[model samples]
Target: MSKRYIITGAPGTGKSSLLLQLQKEGIHCFSELSRKVIQHQQKLKGNKTPWGDILGFAELIYQKTIEELKSPVNEISFVDRGLADMTAYLTSQSYFIPGYLQHFPYKKYYKNTVFLLPPWKEIYVNDPQRPQTFKEAMQIHEHLIKTYKNLSFNIETLPKTTLTKRKEIILSLI
Candidate 1:
C-alpha cells in the first residue's frame, strides 16, 4: 500500500517549502490545494475564498481533496495537508460542519503519523493567498493538533529550525 504521510499546520508555516525540498530529493509530494484554490478564485474574481465566502471555499477544497485521495500515489508520498484540516479550519472559524465531512473516514486514507509545523512568529509572513495574522495562525495550529489527535493520528510537531533540519526530522521519524 502507498503510504500517504501528511505534513499539515496553520498558515505561514514552512509546509510548502519543506515539501518542495522533499520533492526535489525524489520523494513524491502533493501540493496544498488551498493555495491553488485561492489563486484560482482570485483570478476569477470569485467570492469562493477563505476571506470571502469561507464555506464556499471549503466546499471547493473538499471536492478537490476527495479527488486527490481517490487516486493514491504508486509509492510513498507526502501530502501538504489531509482531510481533517478542513474540519479544523471550519471549526476554528465557528462555521457549521457540513454533513459530507462528518462521515469521512480520514484514518483510512492517511498514515498513522502526521507531521505538524508549529506556529513560528519569526518566519510568519502575510501574502495575498495567506492573510491570517500570527495570532490566528497559532489558533489554527491548536485546532489542527486537536483535530488530528481526536482522529487518532500520531502528531509529530516539527521543531522551529531551518528548513533542511525540519526535513531531516521528518525523514528520520518516518
Candidate 2:
C-alpha cells in the first residue's frame, strides 16, 4: 500500500524544512502547492496572489494538489500540504468554501498520518511570498487544525524542536 504523509501548518512553520530533511534521506517527497503557486504567480506579476485573486489561487492549488496525490506513491511520499489547506486559507480570508472544493474527496487521496507544526514566532519571517504576520499565522494554524480534524485525519502536532526529531517521529509512524 502507498504510504502518503502530509506536513501542514501555519506559514513559516518549517513544513518544507522537515520535508527537505526527509528528502535528503532518499525519501520521496512532493512540494507544497501554495508556495509553487505563489512563485509562479509572482513571476508572471499576476493578480492570483493571496491578496489578489484568492479564489483563482485556491482553484489552482486544488488542481495541483489533486495531480500530486494522483501520482503513484513508492514507499513514502510526503506532501508538504494537503487539500484541507484550501479550506483553511479560504476560512482565514473570510470567504465561503467553494462548492467544488467542498465536495473534493480529500480523505480518499490522503493518508491518515498528518503532521501539523504549530506557529513558531521565533522562526517566523515575512518574505515576498509569505506576507502574513505571526499573529495571523497563528490564527491560520487554528483553522488548519480544525480543518484536518473535521476531515477525520490523525493529526500529530510537531513540537518546536530540531529537524532530526521531527523526521524521526514521522519515520517512526511508517
Candidate 3:
C-alpha cells in the first residue's frame, strides 16, 4: 500500500500553497475538502457551509476524504487534511463529534507523523473564504494539535518561514 501523508493545521497557514507546490513537483495530492465545499456552497447559495451548518460541512468533508482515500495509487499520496481536521473543527464549534469518527482508526488511513503548519500572522489575510480572526486561527491550531495527539499521531509542527522554505521542510521530512 502506498503511504498516506496529511498536512493539516489552522486556516491561512499555507496548507494549500504547500500542497500545490508539492503537486507541481509531481507528488500525488488531494485538495483541501473544506475549501472546495465552501466554494461550491457560495456559488450555489447552499446552506451546507461552515457559517450555516458546520456539521453538514464536516460530513461533506469526511465523505470526500473517504472517497479520496479509497483510490488506488502506487506512489505515496499527500492529503491536505484528514478526519482529525474535521473532528477538531466540529469540536471547536461545540458540535458533538460523530461516534463513527471518534472511533475511526486514524493510523490506518494516515501516516503516523502528521505535518502541522502553524499560523503565520505576518502572512495571514482575511478573504471571503477565510474569515477567521488571528485569535480564532490560533484556537483552531491548538485544537488540531490536540485532536491529532488524541489519535496518537506524531505531530510534526512545520517551521514559520517562507513558502519555499516550508515546502523544502515537508519534502525533506517526507
Backbone clash tally for model 2?
A: 0
Residue 153, candidate 2: alpha-carbon lDDT: 89
Model 2: per-residue Cα lDDT over 27-96, one tens digit each: 9988888888999999998878777898999889877876777789876788888888889988987999
Ranking by TM-score: 1, 2, 3
The candidate 2 region of ten consecutive residues with least summed lDDT is: 104-113
**Per-prediction TM-score:** 0.96, 0.95, 0.94
Q: Considering every candidate listed, which one attains the maximal lDDT?
A: 1
What TM-score does candidate 2 get on C-alpha atoms? 0.95
All models, RMSD in angstroms: 1.1, 1.2, 1.3
Error of 1 at 65 (Å): 0.9
What is the number of backbone collisions in each predicted candidate, taken in the order shown?
0, 0, 0
Candidate ranking (lDDT, best to worst): 1, 2, 3
**Tens-digit lDDT track for model 1 on 108-143?**
778899999999889999999998999998999999
How far is 22's C-alpha from truth in model 2 (Å)?
Answer: 0.5
C-alpha-based local distance difference test score of model 3: 0.85
